[model samples]
Target chain A: MFQVNADVIAKEEVIPGVFSLTIVSPVISENAKPGQFVHIACNQGGNFILRRPFSIHRIVPGKAFEILFRVVGRGTEALSRVKVYDILDVIGPLGNGFKYSERITSALLVAGGLGLAPLLYLAEELTNEQVKFYPMLGAQTKTKLLRYIDFKRIGKKTYVATDDGSSGHNGTVADLLNRTIHYIRPEIIYACGPEPMLRKVAQTADEFGVKCQVSLETKMACGVGVCLGCACVTRQGYKMVCKDGPVFDARDIIWDKEEIEPTLLGGYRCETAKVSDPG
Target chain B: MKNPVMPASGTFGAGREYSEFIDLNCLGALVVKTVTLRPRDGNAPPRLYEVSSGMLNSIGLQNEGIDHFIEHDLPYLRQFDVPIIINIAGNTLEEYAQLCREIKGVEGISGIELNISCPNIKAGGIAFGASSRLAEQVTAAARYNTDLPLIVKLTPNVYNVSKIAQAVVYGGANAVSLINTLVGMSIDTNTFKPHLGNITGGLSGPAIKPVAVRMVWEVAQTVKVPIIGIGGINSTLDAIEFLLAGATAVAIGTANFVNPRVMIEIIDGIESFLRQRNMSDIRQIIGKVKV
Candidate 1:
């Protein structure tokens, strides 16, 4: 939990509404772990009040760190305005990250759209460890896919799926998983994507008797666990995503349907665990 | 004696939330959220709604109760040198007394702030806050139970806040904190309906600052006890206005949502202003009425 003023070294529009920001923070870059995030204070002293949380896409050793995100709302829109050399107040390397085990020789990486951010670092780490990586990338279209060259360079076998059949396999990534699960026979599966995608992966992994870990996203207030705003339903009960986990074993989550139903207002209903008290 | 900056209860939590971005020890003091006899789940979803310049929240004082707080939060709070003001709310006089009695021996707790103005829950919610008699009774009951300094938190929705402040003071309150979030409502323009799940909620932010400052001035002139002013205090200038209006201390509330580091910024701004004004100490500006 360190606050450092990071300078934007590079900003690139990877796809429509999607961007990749490279910030020069050696301290954060050297310490960041896969699945952890940095809270980027956008437009300091401006109207954008809260800091935007972004998953660390890739940590470039001692040089800098990268965050990939989509311009979903005002916070991200303000972040998109940031240019090269613009200083940002960032607090980071926060929340528990994926615990990579050396016993797992073969690994499966599943990603949907921008969920690919955190997995990129895990992929790099896996390659460094000489672990077999089977990367399953998903996007609405070929244009939405990111870091294609990087994945191709490192992954032992990279599979791609686009919803519109614009490129790669003409199906969802889950459909591709159904076809490739037997061939890869991965020892462990790691996934970060839409809840539906993660649910499908979780169910599939359970059926195949393979261990699975998932990263969840929730509405957060204090990213340090005090607010209890970013809580999720887990097997044990309610657990704060910012503290107990952003990453949890798929079997550990409760995944209640009624709680996750879309609210009358357009936004998703907060599916926080039904804790007796939130303090 | 006056113009101390304090963190709003519940709004500031235990200060650990912002420890990542700002140092909690630098602030004058911090007010932890209202604790109860038992853990409370609080209100349902849609507890918060954004209005023009402020927001309404029906958080309902969701806390881990007194016992859990004493065991878990107090030990962590003791590490900070700044004073820790514990805020406690109760459904009955006995409950309030029991809570006070329990905190009497707590080592880290510097003071106790009686939350007499929670609008979210139906229990002892607005009962103690809406009347001068009940406020006095609860304050006196709490005073009898504990030897710690007591500050009575006043609701802004009352008819005459000065009367209520005076009542709490007479009841043996060491201090008074004014203008707890005002009762407010917001409508969804499209649905033509109330926005918040609780329908009515407490409003806090820059929108209510002026009202809060006026109330602080009114209560300051009438009550003998120290006043901690709160409402929409997002900056040092805001804090200064409350001070000039007669607040011994000011609490930062809704601004935490807008920017987690706003408290540190206000502290720095106040220090800078003091240096620029050639003031030697913070006490010089506390309640120094211009007229």
Candidate 2:
């Protein structure tokens, strides 16, 4: 809950339209967990009112913690204008993050686009626990695909997919899952990606009788869950994405494409499904 | 007195959600939501939008009304040690007086802050705040209802806000808080449409701090009562600017959306600034600048 003006230590263009920012915040670095994010105030002292939420990419153990994000919207565009040593007002390690369970033996990680940012740290945590990792990376094109060398270095095996035929397998990440799920046969799956991709993955996992968890994104007013801005329909009814999740079991959610009406329900809607009775 | 950082109405609920992260008692004061005569559902969706260095919100003063607040929120808020400033809004002058009288004897209630600046609804949207006569009439009505310190909150939308400040003072306001969120709009260029559900919303955050400071300075000079400044206060320096510009206290609004602990930080920042400057009392800094 501390508001610290962090300095940008490094910045890199990971790919076109994708840039990574590393900031210095010892408070955040020490307290942050996998799947947790920081709300960064960007561009000339609060010019952009809402703080952009970025996953704790890798907490470099130094005086400051690091957050990795792509230049996605007006907030990120303003973030790129920040220079080294320039201060950023950051509030985070916010929201309920992913839980790392010791009982899980093997892990299947899935990501699409910038959603991969949080998954990278989850992989790192799993590696420390000596859990076997099956990582699937997806992007629209080869150019959009994140460099996989880091995941390859630690993961047991890594699969890559792209929508356009410019990368590893000419298919969506879900297509890759359909082809490989039987071979890998993971005990538990953790996925973050577009709602459609995650929905399909959830369905596939349910059919296979395997447990799956997903990281949901919503337009958050108070990332701490006070405003009820970021809410998702779950089996229990409306749950605050900022508090109950950013992470939820795939089976727990009620997916509805129509319910996901834009601007009406935090800029994203899903009306096709409702959370089944929690009982 | 302690640390001059208070939460804006409707922004910081009864301080229940904030207790998990920080101590609510450390704040100078706690301002509850704008309570009406009855429970309000608030405005439609798209209640908020991000503007340049600021954000616009049309929450429409949504709350469970005065009776519900007195029965529910007041009991919970009384547990805290800090003063409670009740923000009251109404469609008519009699309604305002009725609501004020209802909370007049509540334990732990330190004062009443008349919310005459909310622009999200039509019935009273800048109606009382835009003119000195209306502002005075509302202030007088609320003042007659309560013996507690009456703080009239002035809107920034009016021309010569100082005149309204003066009117409220003459109407028997013990203090005044200014400026409330500035009215503004945003457009989605791709769809060529407005961004918020209310079409136009009140803007708050760092973008409007300069305007708020100017208004606070102007009102401070014109009115004899204390002035509590609000708008775009995200950091310590911003808080200092408000105090130097003639604010007896400051309220943190939109920054609460970005960081919930912002009020706590501003409180600590003020103390640190005072320590660094070798000042002991906070009053030494308040209204130090006369321009």
Candidate 3:
């Protein structure tokens, strides 16, 4: 892991409140792998103490990367106020990254809401590696839906599900997976999103007996493994989400922990994952 | 110890998680989380919540029990050149003695830090540290079982922290580390619910530094034993503040979360500061705060 002062190369409010911040950090951008994340310091000390952890949304080649986030709290709010010239203190290329084998030829990319953040990089990598992938995106509505056409550009086929029928299937994305897993015949499945949606996706993967790798999100203190603050249970026992994995094998995850209250977006009922093309 | 830069108990796990980020041998000491007599499941989800200038945590000292520490965690730590101090807790008074006896027989262990101030657990945490009588009793129990350097960690939740420090000193504690996270709470404005799963947690970070420094200065005057200052120490300036306030050593707790190399940085910074002051020994500055 490396800590560096990344200059804000560009900023775009992809949609109101949610932002896509491109930053210049040669060391971190070059080393960051698919599914790994960067912890960004929100402010210079006062009021906001902990650095917020963000998924390595996309790597801009050798010396830049983008992180997508919404201004939900003070930290993000502080981050949002920074301009193009601002410098962000970032520590990254952290936790374990998603694993892919040379033999795998086809795969399914599943994401729920902001869960789409980590998978776009995975999709781009699979494309580069000569693996065909079917990308599935889900959200609460059309506006909240992360509309990225690049998934279709790089993917063999793209699928979407939203709760409001604002854009693909008018149901949960897991339901879409259940209905279409056979047609896709993917050799591997990769996912990221709210815990509730991930739980549902795990069920679908279990029924089909496909190997699924999931990137989890939790309220973390130290982005590193030290705090044991971001605990996720597996068959083995409690594991630090930041260390043992922000990514884990689908079958090994034990969700017996109490149901985390619905997230602003992650908390979507199973019905939200279905997305339709805005076109 | 080369310097006072150490990871506070529970903040830095058994030292394996950070092996990739930092060299373990560079630390002044390595203090592991509290070892219990039995395996603990710990608290539920939402165990952490970020607040203004700090964070609240309720991990509840989750551990695989003393057997795992002695057989598994200890050997891994001995690889590092740093001294290994095990922070231990018990559900009851006798359990403290038993734990000390068990660790006393173990090899490669340097010292035992009695954690009588964990706010999250129901038994034996904070309860003992909150009362001078119980604090002294727990210290005496551990001191009787082992001749190893005994350090009693105190909580700041009490009315008179100095009295408790004096009691532990009288009870045979060789050193004392003060202020464990102050008990705190956070409530979400929208849902009108508590932020932490446990409803309350121990607050740590820059937010608690002033309070920690005050308590350190207070306890330093009352007890002659070495005082290991812990609370909101993130930088060289913070460490120097604690040292000037009469701390013999300082542990980096919440600050380690922000920068993995923080302890190393602080260690380097203190050397520079002392060099600039033309001070040859760290003791020259320790407890030398001008009145």
Candidate 4:
């Protein structure tokens, strides 16, 4: 991994509180892989010392990369206020990312809100590899949704899920996956979203006999393995999310506890209306 | 010595994680995580709770034990020319002595930082550091087993830290490092629940630097041993502040996670700081604060 002072190339407000920041970090971008993330310095060693970790949303290889995040914490709020010429100390191409298998012909891409960040890069890579992929995009409402249009430009149609039923399916993408996973039956499922959604996805994929990979998030100090603070519980005991993964096989994750649910509108909201899709 | 800049124990793992980003030989010393007598799984998920300026981590001294370190980690660390200081923690008094005896047989380790100040674990972590009697007993137990330069890492949770520093010194500690993370807690504004899995954690980063400097100055007054000051050190000026407060050296903890090059930058900045002041050596600034 390499750390570089990247100059902000562009900043755009995707939604009201959501931002897409593009930076000229050739070293990181060139070395980056899909599902791997970069640690962005929101402030110097002032009020907040930990650098905010963001998945590589998109890459302009040999030139730049983009990170998509919502104004959830004070750190992201500080990040949203940055202008074009500002410099950010970014350390990246960190952690193990998604690994593609040649045996796979079809795959299902699932995301919840900003969870779409890393999957967007994954989609582009899959497109280049001539793999047919279906993306399940979820949001609270139509305006709050992200990256479906970006997925459309790559290939195929996106399966949209909105909590308010403003879009395709009238529920979480996990609920949608349960409903249609049998009919669609992609070779493997890849997901990144709220923990509750991931739990539901893992369960659905298991029942349908589909392999899955998930990108997990936690309260991390070092975006490397040094601190061992960001522990992701799995069948094989505790693993460091920063080094062992931001990505892992979904079946291997032991998803217990109530951290967050469908994560509607970037808020940790718990709502349950799950009907096991008898598909 | 390359420079008086090293990572605080537990904040830095076996030097393998950062080996990709930095050369291990550039450090004044290499202090690994707090190794225990047995393998510890550490705390559950959400081991970290970030606050305004720093963070609270209740990692609970998670490690693969000293046996794993000797078999797995020692060979990789042997390649570095830097003096390796293993940070050892134990669940009991005998465990501390046993760990010292085991590490003494290892060829690469130059010193031992007895971690009596870890606030997360239950059995005997901060209990020993908080009480002068227990601190003295633990320090002596470690010293009796090995002739390694013993540095007792002090916590800031005590009422009078200087008393404990004096006790450890009297018990045969060669030097001291202050302060380990302060005992702190955080509650989620939304959930109204404790943020960390251990409910409370040790606070570290720039937030605790002032407390660390004050403790270093206090402990420096009570003992003649060299003090390695650690707390919220992020820049060269922060490191220099510790030295002026009577710390012979400083260890950077949370800042290493922010910018991996922070230690290197501080080394370069300190050189320039001395050059600007027309000083030839770092000792000129150590405890040189004007009254």
Candidate with maximal lDDT: 4
lDDT of 1: 0.81
lDDT of 1 by residue, A176-275 (tens): 8877798789999999999888988988888888889998886554566665545566655456787787999999886753563332111112323334
Interface RMSD of 4: 9.2
The C-alpha lDDT values of all candidates are 0.81, 0.80, 0.86, 0.88
- Candidate 1 chain A, run of 10 with poorest lDDT: A262-271
Question: What is the C-alpha lDDT profile of model 2 across A174-256, one tens digit per residue?
Answer: 88887888878989888998899999899988988878989987666666655544556666545667778888889988887
Question: Which regions of candidate 4 fall more than 4 Å away from where they truly are?
Answer: A258-279
Model 3 Cα displacement at A223 (Å)?
1.9
- Give the distance in Å from residue B87's predicted Cα in candidate 1 to where it truly belongs: 1.6
Arranged by TM-score, best first = 4, 3, 1, 2
**Superposition error at A8 for model 2 (Å):** 6.2
- The regions of model 1 sitting more than 4 angstroms off are A178-183, A257-279, B1-3, B17-24, B41-60, B157-160, B182-203, B254-264, B280-284, B287-291
lDDT of 3 by residue, A1-279 (tens): 888888998999989999999999888888988999999888866777788889989988998999998898888898888899898888888888799865788899999988899899988888889888899998888788774598989999899998889889898788788899987878889999988889888888888888899999888877877787888767765678887789999888987554332221111122122333343
The digit string of per-residue lDDT tens for model 2 on B1-291 reads 466889877677777777766788898999887878865555544566776677777767766678788888888888888899999888889988998888877887999999898888777637988889999999999988899999888899987999999999999999998888899999989988787766888888788889999999888778778889998888888989989999989998777777767788889889999999999998999999854
Candidate 2 chain B, poorest ten consecutive residues by summed lDDT: B38-47
